[model samples]
Target chain A: MKIGAVIKISGLNKDFPGGVRALRGVSLEVRAGEFLLMLGSSGAGKSTLLRCINGLVAPTSGRVELNGVPVGAGVKNISLREQRKSVGMIFQQFNLVRRLRVLDNVLCGRLYYNPLLSSCFNIFPQRDVQFALSCLERVGLREKAYQRADTLSGGQQQRVGIARALVQQPQVILADEPVASLDPKSARTVMDILREINQQDGITVIASLHDVDLALEYARRVVGVREGAVVVDKAAVKLTPKDIENIYGGAKEQEVYDGTYGRLEYVRA
Target chain B: MSELKRPVLPPTDRDGRRQSGLEKLLYLQRALIIGFVLAVYLWSARGTNLSLPELIEGFPHMADFFSRMLPPNLAILKDLVRPTVETVQIALWGTSLAVLLAIPLGLLAARNIAPHPTLYATARFILNALRSISEMVFALIFVTAVGLGPFPGVLALAFHSAGMLGKFYAEAIENIDPGVVEALEATGAHKLQVIAFGVVPQVLPEFIAYNLYRLEHNVRQATVLGLVGAGGIGFELITSMRLFKYPDTAAILMMILATVTLVDYLSSRLRARVI
Candidate 1:
């Protein structure tokens, strides 16, 4: 009920088309400067949950408050745009516009700040361009600024995604399976960069992950979802093997879940 | 420990829709499409009174025309230069105007960019209406509006070219990655800003290539428009033929064909490098 909580969700219920419920009366809160890992199986609504917070997917019956302002309201209003400006989302696919240069992709985050003609002309202000370069430097890719995004490796492209988010100077970063397509080393590197940004810049990070070990290693808090409900919410340090087993499922339940749908994890057991 | 060999297995249907390597349903669909096309062509030919006997009777006249066309009347080439240049000018001006108008209209027709149902529908309707009428019909209409001149022809070509380019532009816009748009929106970009940054760059090269193709087409079309009193080589050729000056008409036709061919070759080479 505190006024200053960075994110607040109450009585959130989301049902997609065809009557498949992705969230069922879920309620949770996230504080500033917290690195929260959303843990879930393939169909457990990890993506749906992250999307709801930013109005990407509207909940059927729920209230989502970010920085004390409710999402899913009239999009034409200045306030909704303002709220969205502070939240940056990174996708699993490292969805950089492949034809664009790395620096241009990062500078796209300032589209809201510039006039329509300026963006259309692709003319970035000198300071903004310099700031974007620094963000790329933070991801240790300052030298790759001029290269086409498609030319970079998958891991390097994800770093460009991070750099784009950083250039936004967002208050909260939502990463949906940010390292799913990456190799083990790349996954670790991305996680470490996310954690470092959260710690050093005080930028709140809410990342959905299938890897229990990575979640335990980097995230301060872990919220596990099972069948559209938060079954467990605890500090990552306290998340036990028994908790992971429940999250992963027992032999009998695993057979039912695994037969129809595969598990969502960094590595299959 | 007893070692067991895994049983060799044949591949089963992945989605259970397999009927063999060659699908019977696909073959049936193909057959149906071919049948429909043949039936339509046959029916249209019959309805139009397109008789092979009439064509056979006309063969001699065609041969006589070809005989006259030989040697190409190159002696009159000295006087054909000005009209040929006028044709090129008409195409250039018309294409420039169409390219400018199509850039914005195409954006309006794009489903992703034009979120409002009314605007999207209106844009599509306008483009379809423009496309439905041939460029010749557009030339006729413009000639009626502005009186006899290459100016009307230029205007007509511009409008028709806009409609054709607009459709291609809409498709190119629709194919752009939605992620970039989302990223722009998250940065608090207004709708226009989002389109400028996210939509435009993805579709620019395609737009340029399409415009070049339209320009090439306009060159050919402009000559034909002049036949209707709308003022290029076609006008000169038509007048010469009406006056019974067959040699002059032949000279004009030859010049037009040569210019169109050169333009086509140049545009094709340029387009290949754009992508």
Candidate 2:
């Protein structure tokens, strides 16, 4: 019942309205303290699988057990909000409230702990504010904390998002297409932060990625999904580009690039 | 993984022969719509008895009316100040009260934030009912209930604008980035926290801008509320016009114009600075 493996997804199924199935009998057991990447083509159910893990997307059938607590609609073992507290999430869009200061955006991670009446007025406890500031420092963004979220570069914004998730002190972090919107350089910075956290803090990460090079470079384990089903699950070190391409329905990328998601690297002839 | 069967895309418009048959049909459809609109306008014009000759014939009468009001009676200028200021006060109080009323109702009505379908529908119904009834009608009712004063005028403006402002706020909330909201919710922030952290920041600028616009609009509407005996400069102007004191009426009109323009200037400046 205590935290053991971070995630256990069993026979998970999700169907959107109009009977379009996004996930089909997907099952995964994610141990605590590891970097795992899910790879698939667009609409391959990678995002849905991650969302299901955190209870963002309710599975139509099957189950997801987080820290041994079942999560889904109509299952009242624990409240959905309470269950979500132990799981952090990062998004492709960076999802920071653009109008808020970076520090305020980060502080939102502690909103659950902050009291309802005072937090509604943007007043937080001293400890929460300090922790939010420290989270910013971890991302190397303490200097930018007071600036509006919109004022930062895309990469910096993503870093702020990572810091916000880190403040949750969660058992696991689920990143859904975290770098798809960033420039290659920015993408590297964001990935490096995620990797650093996973290694140094022993926090589990289940990230969905579209880039083969990035997944191979950072993830120790990779799972491939094809048409809403888990097709390939293996160690990343064992994967060839061809293997990843197979997950993508073959040869998705013609040109090779650096690990920063398609930024061209100089080949030393 | 097996051999990939890729989707093949054909190059379009190879000969550059402009658009296809669908485009021609679309243009014809647009033309027919314009023709239909023009025909409706012609039909409407008959109902209003609109005629160029009638306008020409009435030109002299309009000129004669203007001639009677040439010299504005400056004697009544000091007396006008009290009522004019009261008009502005009504608008100020009404708009402030509307904002206070709108914020909660707006949150309740917004589809994304509403806790239940029934709550959203009820909030929407209240807002619509308030909006559909004109402020003039509201003033008439209030004036009857409160026995005629600027209090009734203020109440009228506040109720009507609460509806308008609430609708605007709801739209602003609904249109915001849902992604940001999801980011907060995933952290296990409760409903109010999600709104405070995720929704409020995104819509604050729009809320302020719209409120300023409502304040400016309310000022103009307040002046007319006095025509229903609900206290303002319009009450004074009506008395002058009925007494055939056209010069006094002209003076009140000029003061009203000046006051409206000043409020307009102040509202725009505040909007520029804040938003």
lDDT of 1 by residue, B59-82 (tens): 999888767766567888978898
Point out the worst 10-residue segment of candidate 2 chain B by lDDT: B8-17
Residue A172 lDDT in model 1? 92
Q: Compared with the true structure, what per-residue lDDT tens digits does model 2 show for residues B1-275?
A: 46899986656766556778998999999999999999999999999999999999999999998889879998999999999999999999999999999998999898888887788899999999989998999999999999888999999999999999999999999898878878888898888898888888889899999999999999999888889998899899889989999999889999999999999999999999987
Best by DockQ: 2
- Candidate 2: RMSD to truth: 6.9
Local error of candidate 1 at B196, Å?
2.0
Chain B TM (all candidates): 0.85, 0.90
Off by over 4 Å in 1: A1-4, A72-78, A249-269, B1-39
Instruction: Enumerate the candidates' DockQ scores in order.
Output: 0.34, 0.37
Predicted complex 2: CAPRI docking category: acceptable
| Candidate 1 C-alpha lDDT tens digits along A1-269 | 23367999999997665567778889999998889998877777788788777766667898999876788475446466677778887888777877889999899777766767877688989999999999999999999999999999999999999998888889999998999999999999999999999999999999999988888889889999877788889999898888887776653332112211111110010
TM-score of every candidate relative to the true structure? 0.88, 0.90
